[model samples]
Target: MQALTWWRNPGTKDLDAIVCDGSVRAGKTVIMSLSYVLWSMTDFDAQQFGLAGKTIGSLRRNVIRPLKIMLHSRGFHVKDHRSDNMLEVSKRGKVNYYFLFGGKDEGSQDLVQGLTAAGFFFDEVALMPESFVKQATARVSVEGGKLWFNCNPAGPYHWFKLEWIDKLKEKRALRIHFTMQDNPSLSPSTIARYERLYSGVFYKRFILGLWVLADGVVYDNWAAETMTTHIDDVSGYESYYVSCDYGTRNPTVFLLWGRKDKVWYCLREFYYSGRESSNNWDDSQYVTAMGKFVGTIKASIIVDPSAASFITALRKAGYQVIAADNDVINGIREVQNAMNNGKIMFADDLKHMFAEFSSYIWDDKAADKGIDKVVKDHDHVMDALRYFVFMVIYKQRTATTAKKPVWLR
Candidate 1:
């Protein structure tokens, strides 16, 4: 409530910016966005402003849709120019232009260049590159221009934390921290369900809303007794999938997965080390071996994005192939969450994957430099598992429709 009235409050009117950082589903984005729009429409007119997110699609989905509804309820005229990626808003014969931008990468700085903005609102600012944020902020040259930032907590050494968040007083910015408790709409049971979705570093950052380093074992929740199931116990599988990590000189791995009753089971695995074997298979050879390994099972195959040759071979051999999403840190978090929530399990016979889990520790050297990276050794099966859980299961969990596999169709 204070954050919403900061601009009107005499004591905080002089602040140049507002930063809201907290847990997921903590009601930060909606409030921050509402406050920004109200502040703009009330204090400024016939001017230009900026609304940004990590990507334009996300900005539209997360902010624009709900924001438009809120404005319409209050009798404001809103016009969205999709091709131009801009919004025209007016009320009481007062009009303003709000341009949308995506600060996804270093190149995103160029998109915000050459435009003068009266103010800037960044959603999930922590996910954007520093260059893009700097460029966007620089565009706010209007005399009374202010900044608004909202995001979940990331690493302790993130650039945003060091510059904007840690220096709130120096930057003359108001900072508001929130948790699930702050959101009145969420019930105790709903909050508890979300709380059970994460563990380890992800739990500290996303659930507790703390800026902490990711260290130690990546999947600390993995235990043979609890996380593994015997193959005989798995039945009624509705869909099957194969996730692969292809390597020429290093080890290659393939993990077979099956879904039953909203839970995924790693039913089987195939691991081959080119360096350790007498025969190093080519792309076609690996494809042949994979076909034999997956014999008679109609399943969609998810392969590493970088394996062009292997992907081609698999596709030519009549396999439906999907290029896996390779966002390492996020993928690891999704995999860990799946394990923690009991959405995924491993078959007891998959010894290689179980062995790899014990060695899949966070890179301490990288952590020391404020980066979250997993150790590269003994990670083939681990990578395959991550691919399956993140790309297949995570999407299935969030998607409104559970589409059947091509083979099933």
Candidate 2:
């Protein structure tokens, strides 16, 4: 019944799958695992179920073991859930469950080597490589079988998330999101701990399930094509604007957004890893780099609220900076509008951004309450981009840029 709430009012629709990211207290993993089973039930399949994670040990302990206790306690007839590193459920002697383990280990690929699957779980998804997940999914021969992944946002860089979650987002892949508040059973202490541990973008992504941009974010949607190495100049029919996802120790992210006809395009991004060369040197160097990259594209440069310091420095350094409005949901609304309207595109250099677009998701707990983009971890670039788009690019301060009222993506 609860899963239906999220399914009915998800942030992004057309989902064949979902991703639930939440704080430690949030039952993201539990919700996803149950959703896997719930979705499986709606599909009306008693076929074998599989669960795997970063290692055989983890799979056994985390996925298989706990799931067993959960099912058993819930009156589920789990015929066999053992530390033998296997889990199985049965109704009337028909085996319906089989939990297993896997990872980047070459041998992990062999776990699925010979078996046909109805569906499977890939836990700790952020830790696994994209190659490993791909190989495992390919091995699923059960028609219409789903491959589900659950993980907390772990790093500024990860390949699987970039490809599956991030890329699919731009192309508009099916997905769902969640956060700790979604689960009513969590203790307050856990929530408080997570709140204390993360802040700003990090907190938003992991705890809130917001799809903001991170330092490693790569996508310049304003480019001629999503991923072109071509040096040809791209023309546009609309004005241009820039959105910056500010970071200090992390890489500073800059995206140059442009509007053409009715679409929003990200032409290029300026991402810097190393520290500024001179202490006196304002970050304008990045802005300068972005200026050269965009050339004469006449558009205002919009930045996130976090960039207040950066913007101040830029202004002191004599650079023009237009701060992005950064209205959480409103920004996401604009991006969704551009995407659903088929008016968004990416530049070649924006690969990372593209990846984030696909991989980013919402916090399901928030979705259940009809709150979209609840700031789960893993997809910050997407969040930052949304702010840049709606709050700044899509809105004309001179004219009201009204968007759809609150709705889950």
Candidate 3:
């Protein structure tokens, strides 16, 4: 409430911006977005403004939909020009225009280059590149223009943390830190459910709302004894999948997965290290081995995106191959979440995968540079596991869970 009236309040009138950073489901996004709209409508007239998220689709789903409802209930007229990605809002003869933007990558700066905005609201600003933020902020040139930022915390050395957050006084920005406790809408059970969704670095960032390092093992939830399933004890397979990490000079690994109910079992593994072998297998030879490994089992094969030749060989051999979604960080998080939720279990006989799991650790050097990376060593099987869980299982689950609004339907 205070943040919404900050500009009007004599004590905080001099502040130039507002930043809300905190835990997930903590009310930062809702409150900050609402405040931005209210502040813009109250203070400005017939002006251009900007509202952005990591992607236009996300911005609409997270901010625009709920915002439209709130405004309508408040007796304001809202016209969405979907084709133009703009909103025409008015109340009591007062009007304003809000343009939408997606700050998804380094090239996103081009999207906001020509706009002259009275203010800009960035949701999940930490996910956007520094270049996009700089370009977006530069467009807010109108007098009394302000910036509004809301995001879950990232690394300790993230640009926003180093600049806007650490130098809050210098930037004259009001920083509001939030936790799940601040969101009255979330019941205790809901908050607890969200808390169980993350562990290790993610837990610290999304649950505790801390800007800390992602150090130690990447999968703190992994345990060979508890996470592995005996093949003889499982049955009733619904489908099967083969996830591959193809390498010529390095190591090539293929993990065979089978699903039963909500749980996916890593049934078997085929690991070959070319460096350790006297001969490096060609694409055809690798395909032959994969055929033998997957004999008579109809399964979708997911392979590393870089293995073009290998993928062609598989396809030529009458096998269906899918290029894995190779987003390392997101993949790792999904895999970790699967483990935390008991969605995945490995066969006890898969010795090589268990070995790789125990040895896979976060790259401290990368963390020190404010980057999240796992050590490349001992990760072939782990990569294959990540590919299957993230692309096939996690994506399907996410799509299934995201309910579209009634109007959109």
Top candidate, metric lDDT: 3
Stretch of 10 with least lDDT, candidate 3: 400-409
* Candidates' C-alpha lDDT: 0.88, 0.59, 0.89
Find the candidate with the highest TM-score and give its number: 3
**Candidate 2: lDDT over CA atoms?**
0.59
Models, CA RMSD each:
4.1, 18.6, 1.7
Considering summed lDDT, which 10 consecutive residues are worst modelled in model 2?
Answer: 215-224
Against the true structure, candidate 3 reaches a TM-score of 0.95
Once all C-alphas are superposed, what RMSD does model 3 give against the true structure?
1.7
Candidate 1 segments exceeding 4 Å error: 232-236, 401-409
Model 2 lDDT tens row, 1-409: 3444444445633444555544445565666676666555545445766677887766654555556566666566664444555555544334465657678555566666666677777887766666666667776667667667777654333454556667665534454456676778767886675565444445556677654444321222222333234324566546776677766644566777766676666677766545553233346766566667667666556666777777787677455777777666446545654543355666666766756655555554554433344445444566557767676536654256343223200
Ranking by lDDT: 3, 1, 2
- TM per candidate: 0.95, 0.45, 0.95
- Report the Cα lDDT for residue 308, model 3: 95
Clashes found in each candidate (C-alpha, N, C closer than 3 A): 0, 62, 0
- The candidate with the higher TM-score, 1 or 3, is 3
Clashing pairs in 1: none
Error of 3 at 215 (Å): 1.1
